[model samples]
Target: MSFIQSLKSSLKASLGSKQRQVSAVPQIAAKASENPDLEKLLVIPVSDDPKEEQQRSHAFNKGQFLARQERWEDLSKIVNDEDQNRRASGGGMPIAELLCQGARADVVALAEHLLIDGTPEEARPLSEAISALEQILGEHSNNHVIATIVAMAHLDIAWAWRGTDAVRDTPARNLEAFELHCTRACQVLDPFCGIELDSPLVTSARCALLVGTPNAQTRVADDYEDLIDLAPEQQRHIRALGHHMLPQWFGSYETLELEARRTAARTQDIWGAGAYTWTYFDAVLVDPYCARYIDIPFFLEGIRDILERSEDQHNANLFASFAAVSIPNAAHLCADDLESCSALEQIQTAAQWIMSDYLHELHPLIWGHAMEGFDNHARIASIDALFKQGREKANQVFVRIFGEQMRKGNALIFTPQGLYVQQA
Candidate 1:
């Protein structure tokens, strides 16, 4: 029996209830020999379409090339384009966000290298890049877009210097460097803080600065609130709000719950109850202890609302994979504490209706990323291997859930257009 299946069997024995509870994790119903036609299924993962992939590639490559060549003016134009603020049709990510990342990818990577091991030799390139960026800022002091890029570069380097170790563990010299970089980052962006002057880049830099700011604990919600309001279509901002509101970051569990609801109301016009779902989504993924705090019915309702509102298959696959794989994995990790935990069991059970009602096509990249909670440093042998692993798992999930349909002379096919059935 699987972990959840074993838990269910135990529950039934203990409760003495006549009603059967479905397994949250799929319970394989029929043997493979019983369904020889399953091998012909076409349920592998795929992108939304090739054209959207090409467009995303073009945007990133062009922006990175502009940044590498130091054509700041040209890069500014792309970031300032109205389309940049709009969410991409392929996935919900903001186009301008990618442009900003491309603009500072070189500097940020160097800073990240210094953050990890702090080798003196690794610091030279980062220092040189900061100096060059600082000089350009002096020449174009009033250009808010240019100032935003430099601010983010400094902000990242600041984190690199401070590192994630506790205060006592951090060296005094590193603390001083962290402060110096943070100060410079704030100074450049301070004048552009007003609403009229804010752009997507400017708003992002402000949010990033909250880590080093003295007033962050009280201001985390406010800063993110401004961001979500500016682009209510962007669910990423709402997701981030829940993260910073966590007890370890700026707020307590109560604060996280409150902010999730507040964001739901605030963005109801755009996301409906989806804002609440996105807020709690990443937090619980990274730390399952937070799962204990989730309001089961409300959270599940938010999930339904999200799938109903968003047409993007990426999101449908994202939540489906998250529920079926990620959250159940969390439950397994905390199995000792979960046996009597009814809420956690119900949370795991949510995957069933989500897969049945919402999921149409598979996106292996999303499923693969969920296996590691989308960690930046999750080790993988190769992209092809990652997708292959994800594909196999996804097929297992679908076969278990839709097995009856498959055995009855129907082949489930997931194309970019949508889910289709072939008569077997």
Candidate 2:
């Protein structure tokens, strides 16, 4: 039997409850036959028809969509084909000229794909992506999306080369380049209302470039305060991200947790699974350096309370519980065996264990999506049935089926657009 099927069988045997009529559930299984990297969650859907002049702008969006999905190979193929086609038609396409979303998708795809791969050959493509983005910005300096994307590309290039032999030769120069991109992005984004703390562009850039800098704690906290008016879900995401980012810049754990409590209190959704905040929260706990300051069990107990009070709970709660149960022991394991205990390895192992033991009794569809290497779903059931089974088992299921998913390689890519963005 499949994982969930087996779990149901066990439940019937143990509880002696009559067989409940099972129903179909919305399956969150990603593309089964493909590697997780090619999967996407399209966030900003584009119109099918576009004016000739609108094509270039649309191309950028399409590229971003592909990039978010992490479809690197497809993106590369499309970019190459478009470049060849454009050359055959008329080789003199100006960088400043806006292409339809179709054309822009090629350039955006190249830039983002290079960001995740981190190959030495990526240098040329990174430069090309920036140049194209710059051209777009030159003509449309006020365009926040273009400016933000340009900044993201710059940061990605910098991240791709960090600690590399080439960049190590003059690290300061490389950092300066990143700062320049940030400055450029902020020039366009800062003038817009609610972009500083709210924009993915600004928040992500700050986390990447500014996190380790001096006095980042104060600035990040201030940003949180400004974001209070946003919906609780957004606030939780930003705050949780802040929790992860602040400590690197010397933010106090006590202070950070205090803020987190306040944010938690504001949320009507007790489990806080509405966003990917739990991932960030779990990430903090997994850090050995971070564990010294946190009261692991205490922190988890609070989460447990949220889960208990949560109206509609799911696998996220179980994932959180699994982390709470497994992380401390995992940390000890890592401390004992440094070779095996890399942060990514810790998360991967935790996920595997959760699949095998905790949610292992549940459906592959319920927690299979939660596991790292496993993608193919064995079955699907009703959302209500999943919840019912989850309640019976004192577990729940969650759908983190979209938004930016980071792979084990430490490469981050945004998923394709969906009704629910995970805010990763």
Candidate 3:
């Protein structure tokens, strides 16, 4: 069978059971040559104003929401409207190419979520979204934006199948679709490699090929040098992903941190540095060998240093939040020995340090939950008013009063069942 034939067969199979036979459908071979202005529709514009930026943000977010809602028809309208508007204006594509790119990623994400949940009914929406994207790609084969989106759509289909036991049981046929889609995605991105190095879509595709599933593993680490050379700012939010992924390729903690710091210095973005550091800590927290390899105190001290070095309050808060999540898990490793002792004292010590250092940072996050109000905005504003009122009181009194107010009946408490929210 041809590529499109195989894809059609796959889509048909998704419509029902794997054993269902699919009738031959005419191959969708519509090429981009037919659409001379296709490239014009795929241009991504930079945001120069708040309104433009918000619109762009909203477009992408709405696309994601549509995908999650399984509203395939709505998604199709978005792409079509953007194409029409782009042609009419000869500029300012309604759906930014980046948003379209994200739409494909969202398709893949929703597909995986459905597969994991093991609900065949959920697959229908994914199949619909996938078919729609495929149709779009059929017409715009050479449009790199749509091509990337289509490629990722294919990758997601393959990823979903890889996780399904029915597909994996057939070794020869198992990754057939998966391999094809991954190759297609790579080929699409390979032509204009440098342009997409910073894209989360591209980064995620590369990561999927590397560490995905056993059947989906491509082990091809391409364009990483180009990635490392790009400054943190240039890398978008995805620069931290390198630090997250390189360990699987035999990179060490020190080397990864050095690369992260170098990228941070090159970009002079402290927030990126904090984000990068958090990725490493996140990895270690899941299975904290870092604490064993180095001393637990040393591991925690490094996190503290990152938090302190963060120039922006947001960055500092972000790093502290990561520490708050990671440190408690890692505390058991903090004892004089990992195998010999429980490390309860060390855990207590670490928790105390985090509480002391990050209480102010945690206050804002917990404050909303504590406040009784109509909505988030009202609650958050009420917190500000309370904080202001407290500030007028003595500093010590203010800290005690607001801290107690926020913690009362709104704190997260561990119970026999699981983590429970204390009700106000």
* Best model per TM-score: 1
Worst 10 residues of 3 by lDDT: 370-379
Error of 2 at 320 (Å): 5.7
List model 1 lDDT by residue over 1-424, tens digit each.
2222332343333334333222133233444445435567645446633344465666777767787676888878777774335555355556776666667766665566455634565455555667767777887788777888788778777777776422347888889998888888888889896357546557867887877788789888888888878777777777877877877788888889898998899878777788888898877765566777777788888888888886667677778888777777767656666642455667667776776566666667667767777654454556666676666566666766677778786877755454567786
Tell me the deviation in Å of residue 370 in model 3: 19
Q: Comparing candidate 1 with candidate 3, which one achieves the higher TM-score?
A: 1
lDDT of 2 by residue, 1-424 (tens): 2222332343333334333333354443333323333234222212222232144345555565654454434544554344323221111121121222332344433433443333444356445445645665565566444454455455444443343221135557556755565555455455544444344323434444443345655576555544433323232344345445444444655665555555554553534432223423543543444544444444444444444443222343345334533454445644764543454244433443333222212222223222221111223245445444333222221222221242232222222221222433
lDDT of 3 at 53: 36
- What lDDT score goes with residue 265 in model 3? 51
Q: Write the per-residue lDDT of candidate 3 for residues 1-424, one digit (tens) a residue.
A: 3323333454554544533222232222333333222223212121122233355567777766654454555665565555333321111223434456456555565565556544666566665666666666666565555555576567656756564222236444546756666666666555533335344334444443443334321232233433334323223323334334344443555655554444445444434334344434434443344433433454455456554653323333233333333344355554445532333234224433443443332223322222211011121234345433222221222223223533353443322232333455
Best candidate, lDDT: 1
Predict model 2's lDDT versus the native: 0.39
lDDT of residue 284 for candidate 2: 52
The CA-based lDDT of model 3 is what? 0.42
